[model samples]
Target: MRRTTAAIAIIAISVPTVPLTYGRSQVGGARVKQYQEHLRTVLPEADHFVSKGGEYPHFRGYIRGTAGEVDKLVGLAYLNSDVGHAITGYASEIVVMVGLRPVGTITAVTVVTHNEPYGYRSIDLARFKNQFPNRR
Candidate 1:
């Protein structure tokens, strides 16, 4: 009985300790839909937009679309978890890959204010603006 009680207590204690991770779905299906809607509004001429599973952290999806930009491609992604936590308020390095090559990069990543954690200070947008231009 003691062992069972101790086990339950241990599990309860560890539950909250486990970090929360957000994926494309974690952002909420409605939010993802909203983002897609916003993207469509911003890039109305896009040929098409597709979403796929991401490879790291809390990344939920990899969005690809074609607009009138030089590269004609843009990506939208979401991160949730410790990896997300680290980059929550800052823009981290993002490499945009083209057919077997990296084409452009986004620098000074900043978290969208709506996604910011409660009680934490706001991050400077200028601090996380684009830093990398086109790189081979």
Candidate 2:
């Protein structure tokens, strides 16, 4: 009876630990690398990004030189979920990363993630995505 109780306790402790470790690994894994690529796609001019803290968080885009970042601000990039929490697609939320010039012109908009059933035929198309860039 004591052995059985000890085994049960060990299983309970180990089960939760596995998921926590897995979750942390994922944060630093392929998905994060892909998202960084997405950010670069939208804000190609920015060689470096600095997170700006606010009620709605955003990245201040900058061009890094041999010394460091240039004083001139290039653009801004942010996720839609940070500003538009209530927006959702058919299956789930459609997260987008938007880049803008200093003058507020949209540089580009890229869909970071979406789960809509027919999204590939529409939202994933270059024609649809192309419309956002250069827009106010």
Candidate 3:
């Protein structure tokens, strides 16, 4: 048997609305719920989130952190980030495939992905991520 899963992130981008492929409305409620549960785990400071669209032509999600203790907002987007290696030569063709792409606020500097060697923990602690959130 084959298994499949869906992820959702509440992002704040001004791009035009995109369509979702898994059907709209209550049809994929289960997957949305699942995404919410997992997002809560990854972003415990988040109070709640809102998602846009239902399929992949331009599916996106977003959440705000207003619990006082949390200082960042979250969004879902699909990105084709270039990946490089310490020993291997840098190549633009080497792209990081993201399954669940999480980026911080409007000007947010944080991002999350499932690529190896990208080092999520270290990246999270990097100084660059501390930049001010986008106010747009």
Candidate 4:
């Protein structure tokens, strides 16, 4: 007999309705680096990120080529807000970053920030985040 487990990549927490303020002109170079660091946690194979615009805004993660140029597409990273989801947690909206493979499987999910009081304890646990990886 075989047992199967289903994992939903979506997770909710709490966050304020504010646009991201991470840009070279707004928050300085260090802030951008910090944001990228967060992104790397979900898409470790990505070495370069390019912002893509559309109904579902996302970042195209790419890997560097042999000659030190970014040429291969690795995965896509996007925030829940980009998909226009009104999903909220205990307090408010939960901002989460999700990395997905081209074949529609989830690579990983990372909670960028949250405003949950009690929920934080559970959401912050590694096991909670670990369950999201390799799921569809």
Candidate 5:
């Protein structure tokens, strides 16, 4: 009886630990390293010149455009069926807003809005908000 209990405890502990060890080796470490290198390469060129204070740090002088200029602004699409299943009821569509300063410099990112049924109440305006003073 004692041996069985010991074995059960050992299995419980090892099961969670296996993911911590194997998962890190598989992709987590490599993904983190890649992101760090990517961020290092992109930070210098992006300009942040917002003087107005707010809940979050203002990232101004990034992309120059207005709210209606959705087509002109770059869009990043994450088309993962698994993510679709997890968040929304159907695996049809998912739109997440991410704040981008330049090609590589991402200052702040928040989920603006989603077509999903149940999620955040109000969209975060900051995600799509950009102040570009130099654009024509």
Candidate 6:
């Protein structure tokens, strides 16, 4: 039974399930605008952006329009986080919003939210996010 359960779990995860906004309660429409604003800090050249597709565990699909329809793509943006906590010990999810170039390199990453220790958060946000603009 254990082996069967494990196999089922693996198959369930391996199969590409059409992401139905995993945890709909967690991702709201507001996060779309939030991520778009975050994306602008990295992709000012995109000109137009829209997040209309479903959200996944770490991926958000969006439409990018640049230099007219000829240059277009249904880009997948990433919003992820490192786990940390405040002094009180509650889990604080740090959400990092990021976009990728067509070649699969990171274009930019913005730290969107966190509940880190006050002092550490105050200084680390900018420096940490600044590193991912052109990384792969």
Look at candidate 4 and give me any clashing residue pairs.
14-93, 15-93
Model 3: per-residue Cα lDDT over 24-68, one tens digit each: 432234445535544443334455544444333222344554577
User: Residue-wise lDDT of candidate 4 within 1-136, one digit each (tens)?
Assistant: 1222222222122223343553122232333355696679878898887776656667778887888674898898877766767458777777788899888888988887777777444455477678887888
Error of 6 at 21 (Å): 12
Provide TM-scores for the models: 0.34, 0.67, 0.28, 0.68, 0.23, 0.54
Stretches of model 6 off by over 4 angstroms after superposition: 1-31, 52-71, 81-91, 120-123
Worst ten-residue run, lDDT, model 4? Answer: 5-14
Provide the overall lDDT of each model, using Cα atoms, as 2-decimal numbers.
0.38, 0.70, 0.36, 0.69, 0.34, 0.56
lDDT of 5 by residue, 9-123 (tens): 9999887645321122224234334233222222334322222222232222334446765223232212122123323424333433223443544443333225534445543
Off by over 4 Å in 5: 20-82, 86-136
lDDT of 6: 0.56
Q: What's the distance in Å from true for residue 8, model 5? A: 1.0
Superior by TM-score: candidate 1 or candidate 3: 1
Per model, state how many residue pairs clash: 5, 0, 13, 2, 0, 0
Which pairs of residues collide in candidate 5? none
lDDT of the structure predicted as candidate 5: 0.34
> What are the clashing pairs of model 1?
24-60, 90-109, 91-109, 91-110, 108-128
Best by lDDT: 2
The better candidate by TM-score, 5 or 6, is 6
* Ranking, lDDT, top scorer first: 2, 4, 6, 1, 3, 5
lDDT of 2 by residue, 40-104 (tens): 88889877666654667676777765566445678987777766664576677777788999999
Q: Can you rank all candidates by TM-score, best first?
A: 4, 2, 6, 1, 3, 5
Model 4, position 112, has a per-residue lDDT of 78
Model 4 vs truth, CA RMSD: 16.2
